[model samples]
Each structure stands twice: as structure tokens, then as C-alpha cells.
Target: MDSRRAFLKKTLISGTGMALSGSLMPQSLLAASSKKITILHTNDMHSRIEPFPDDGGTFANMGGMARRATLISEIRAKEPNVLLLDAGDIFQGTPYFNFYGGELEFKLMSKMKYDAATLGNHDFDNGMDGLLGQLPNASFNFISSNYDFSDTLLHNQFSAYKIFNKGGIKIGVFGLGIELEGLVAKENYGNTKYLDPIAVSREMVQQLKNKKCDLIICLSHLGYSYQSQKIDDRKLAAQVNGIDLIIGGHTHTFLDHPEEIINKDGHKTLINQVGWSGLKLGKIDFAFGKKNEISYANSEPLAII
Candidate 1:
């Protein structure tokens, strides 16, 4: 008789627990308490190891690699979920690149702990051989969804995409380069096939989404806009979907903040660029709150001067 009574009591308790659990809050509600993410990015640094000389130009005495390093370190110290990234054109500006053939550029960027970078037209100044020679110095990876390097020295050095995990949030980053037919010499980008950026970008975004990335970013050497009908960042954003941000280069455009555009799926996409020559460092703070939603986005352009 005692055993029968206990069994009935246990059944009632289990039913009550199941009923309560059925009304439990969703996972997003639990994510309401979490840390945020900050993304620091740059483009077209072009080997400007030191600040531009005090020649009375607009950017004179502004933009030195050391200053950028300090700024990045300070941010990382304060924010555990910080990502430092670059677009392209990491080489071929100052006497350093001319003298050392891109070795110093990779070394400095590695020191700065750049997560990933794309290829720029100017990166091929000394040809594929020169780029391959300096590849060993880079601690970070290279990403490019397009620009097939089959049958070339760079065939295995570059990856199509990479994923970074921070604070339980996943960020998928990829790269896209401009068409090389007219921009680069045949011998410079030898055996490299330039695929359609729009198509390649779509594929990458789908893959990133499959990986359940909270953020998807593209580092592109395509310019911001074009007077002609040539495809640029703006057009690319409109044509594609699932890319959260595009850090652009090649036109050296300076933007104080990111431009928001509606994508094919009608979602907001952001595009940002800092002028070339390492004159500006672009910083964007994205606060991820409940449900991994971006509660705030703040972008600042740092003057090297």
C-alpha cells in the first residue's frame, strides 16, 4: 500500500515538472546576459610603416603602424571579444616594400595580429614569386573566395574562408579581389583565374551561414563605387545576401562611418573603408546582447597624426 502511494506521488511530481518545462523561456531569452563584440578593421595600408611626412598635406604626420598597434592592444585589453582585421593592399607603398619586396609588411602585420587579409592588385608588384617568398612571415591566414590560384605558386597558401570564435560567437571571414586582367600584369598574377565576385560571394555567405556564424565579413579589394557600370561594393551588397559587413579597398576612400544598404533579402548590410597609405584606422564596436542581436554599432576613424 505504501509503494502504491509513492508511485502515484512521483507520477504527479513528474507531470508538474513537464508542464513547467513546456512553458520555459526560449534560448534567446537566456542570452540576454552576455558580453559584446568589437571589430577593428583597415584597408589598403599600402606599406606605410611610418606616418606620412609633415609635408603640409591633409594627412601629414598622421598614420604610423606603431600608433595603430598601441590602439589595437588597448582595445583588446579592455574587450575580450575583439577582432582585428584588414581588407587588402598590405604591400607596395613606402621604401620598405620597394627595398624588401613585401617581407616587412607581412612581418609587421603579423606582429599586429591581423586575423585575415585579402589580395590587392598592388600586392603583385613583384609577381607571384615575390608574394610567395614573403608568405612564410605572415602568422595570419589569407582568404579569398574568388581568385583561383590553381597552377600558380599561391595555389595552397590562400584559403577560401576562415572562421573565428570569440565569446561563444562565431565570425566567418572571406575575401574577394578585383579582376586582374587589366589591373595586373599577366606574369604578375600568373595562372590565377578571377571568378565572378557576386557568385563567389553568395557561395561563401551560404557556407558561413551553414556554420552558424553570428557575423559574416568580406574583405574586398573592389573599390567603393564606380562612375561607370563596373561592379563595386555597393552593387555587390545589393546583389547578395547574408553578408553582415564588407571592408573595402582599392579606391582609398575615407568614411567616418559605415554605409548601410538593403540587400537582396532586404536585410541591412554595412560597407566601410578607410583611405589608403595607413592614414586612418577604422574601428567599429558591435554590442551583442540578448539573442546575439547587435544592440549598437559605433564606427570611428582614427587619425594617425
Candidate 2:
């Protein structure tokens, strides 16, 4: 065990651009009764179906769906338990969205086999009807806890939360969207009621706990932070308990590492976000003990080269 710990410490220190966080237990300590889950996530893709042109811009020739797909495939080939998720803004930005109304984007994500996604304000750029029209192109679910679509055409189209069993470990995931009133046009998101994220998060935690999930994740479209009183991922992490991780979007913040914040119950919650346009894919590996308790976690953002 001591040798394993020393090895892990040395590897971490030698690893470039890797941020080792959370409670870490040496792999040897739990090798006989441990499982590891790798979470691959993205945010604010905004309809970037192809790589940026080699036009000498900052992100020139950087982000592309094809590169991301190849990277994800490579990881899945090596990892037994993996989850691919998005924090939303899947539509609106490139000419592709304008031409196809998000059909191409959804199709590509479906091809990549995304497990789930949340809603971003820009997702409503073409309105609810447009979003509904492209639903058939997607193979995965959309989970949004705070946005009530009861009276819209999107009623019952999304889940408040979903549970998954990966390698005998139960993982719970829920979603939260930014308030769309002013950011989104009234006609675009007609009749969709925005609920309080904090309140909904507390309820989700209790419900997932009752369901005996070992890990709970929040797919949040809330911005990373704000000077004003607007609720952001950081604020949500500080106020809520029981959320193991918060995958954030909407502000297009590029975080090289996941920020660890102690929550209301004094438990640690991790928050991470990659900038918009599919430039980077955030990866977090969590190791669980025999009892499904998280023993170790580490994060790194893989650039889509």
C-alpha cells in the first residue's frame, strides 16, 4: 500500500495539466473491491459541427465534433464504466444550426452516444417547436429539474432526474437551466416555467438518496459565477449538499481544473466547465470502494486537437 501510494503521488506530480482533487485513496488499498467511473463532459457547444477554419484566430482549427468523437471513442475503448454528458447550449451559433435547426448537432451527439444533456438558454434560439422537431435525431435523454414544461409542447419530454447503474454503481443525475425570461425571447420559450434551482436541487438530493444512488451529479446551465446575486454553479455548490459534481455551462468559462467547494453539510462538491464550441472535453475519474463510497477523484481537460 505504501508503495502504491508513493507511485500514485509520483505519477500525479509528473502528470502535466492534471489536477488531482477530492479524497484520494491509493488504488492498491481498494483494488480488490473498487470500481472506477470516468465522466466525460462538455458545455456550450453552440452548433459547432466542424473545426474552426485555419484563419489565424485564437481557436483557429481547434474545435470540431469529429475530433471530440475520436477522443471519446478512445476513452470508452479503455474504460469499462463511462458517462458522456453535456451541460447544454447544443444549438445556435454556427451556420449549421441556422440551416438545419439543430438536426445535425443532435444527430452528431447521438452518434457519439451521449448519455444525457441539459437545456441552455440558447437551446431555445429556434423556439420550442424547433427543439421538438429535432428530438427524433437524438438517442439520449434530456434532464432538466428546474424548468417546468408542463404547459408547453415539450411537456413530459424531459426528465427531472435520471438514475443509471454502471458496473453495479448507481449514479444519479439531474439538470438545472438558467432563467430564460430576458435571455430568451418570450415566444421562444413560451409557457416554460423556471423554478428555483436551489430548492429543486435539495429535493433532487433527497429523492436520489432515497433511491440509494452512490453518486449524484448536477448538469447545470447556470453560469460559473457572478458579482451580482444571480445564482451560479459556485453559489449552488455552497448552498446545496449531496451533489457530488456540478457540470456547468452558459458562461463559456474554461476551467483547467475542477473547483472543489465544501457544501452546506460540509461535504465536498466538484464543479467543472470547458469553454464553448467543443474545444475541450472535461474528464473526471472517480474510484469507488466496495460499498460504493468515492475513494478517489482526479480531473483533466483534454483539448480536442
- State the lDDT at 99 in candidate 2: 83
Q: Number of the top candidate by lDDT? A: 2
TM-score of each: 0.87, 0.91
Candidate 1 positional error at 121, Å? 0.5
What is residue 203's positional error in candidate 2, in angstroms? 0.5
How far is 121's C-alpha from truth in model 2 (Å)? 0.4
lDDT of 2: 0.88
lDDT by residue for model 1 over 1-305, one digit each (tens)?
55323433442343310001121334354334375677888889888877788899877878877777777888788778888888888888789788878876777777778888999999998999999988887889888789999889888889999999988788999999999999889999988998999999999999999988888899989999898988899988889988888899999998777888886578777788988887778777665665776555566777765
Which ten residues in a row are the worst by lDDT in model 1? Answer: 15-24
Q: Which runs of model 1 end up more than 4 angstroms from their true locations? A: 1-33
- Taken over the whole model, the C-alpha lDDT of each candidate is 0.81, 0.88
lDDT per residue, candidate 2, 208-243, as tens digits?
A: 999999999999999998999999999999999899
Regions more than 4 Å wrong, model 2? 1-33
